[model samples]
Target: MKINDILTLYDKILIGFVIILSLILLLIPFYYFGSPAEGEELILKVQQGDELIKTVAVADSYDEPIVFEVEGPIGIHTIEVNQGRVRVQEAPADDPLKICEKTGWVDREGPIIVCVPNSLSLWLESTNSDIDGMSW
Candidate 1:
């Protein structure tokens, strides 16, 4: 078949649209869309019952996991921090759900590790100093 007959007007327009869309999709990641910057300053905040227990800067390298035992409502609970990530290493026996321990390493900001049985929680947050408000 002749090229003209194979690619009609409508077919050409559709092909052009598809090519443009594919190119835009391919280049979207190259244009910064204001996603939270990776490897930025990440702060780990450990809280218990509305009180800020401890704050630590997440480190890239660690000899071993930093372990913390905090007394909670149920009993002693264990928290582990390693390589800019935090997770509940162990939860109290009273925690029937055991959801806290089940929640794996939390490396990004926004996710919170809460041990309901122990009234303990931890979260990673970005220090606003490096984060510009214009990132929208």
Candidate 2:
């Protein structure tokens, strides 16, 4: 109605927003940074661009190499995992660089290998690690 009334309403909305934002900030640490449960295992996650493709247990002992075929815009790319290690075994010939295949093997957490042309990526993750680092 009046200018003063509109200003008062705006103040109320601003206070409500501040209160909600503060609550979210206070609760974020508990939800986002909580300690991992006991006996947590290591895992390897595969993705095509932003989409998640697969998750494999990195701690498990595999009898043979696990092959993962990831299809993207370029073509199909192959990823292999064995004995707690992961490698980009093969990529489409057209990709040329083959950087993902050249990345060799990654066993520990925190390393990520990506095939840019294929839009494929892989990362090693571990909930239980001696080093306190960020992984996601």
Clashing pairs in 2: none
Q: For model 1, how does the per-residue alpha-carbon lDDT over 5-70 read when each residue is reduced to its tens digit?
A: 778899999999999999999888556533347546778898999899988777642666788788
Model 2 agreement with the true structure over 1-136: per-residue lDDT tens digits = 7767667777989989999999999999666445434586668899887889899886564777788788889888888888878998888988988889899998766678988887888987777666677656
Model 1 alpha-carbon miss at residue 22, Å: 12
TM match of model 2 to true structure = 0.63
**What local distance difference test score does each model get?**
0.78, 0.80
The candidate scoring highest on TM-score is 1
Which candidate's lDDT is highest? Answer: 2
Poorest 10 consecutive residues of model 2 by lDDT? 29-38
What are the per-model C-alpha RMSD values against the true structure? 5.6, 10.6
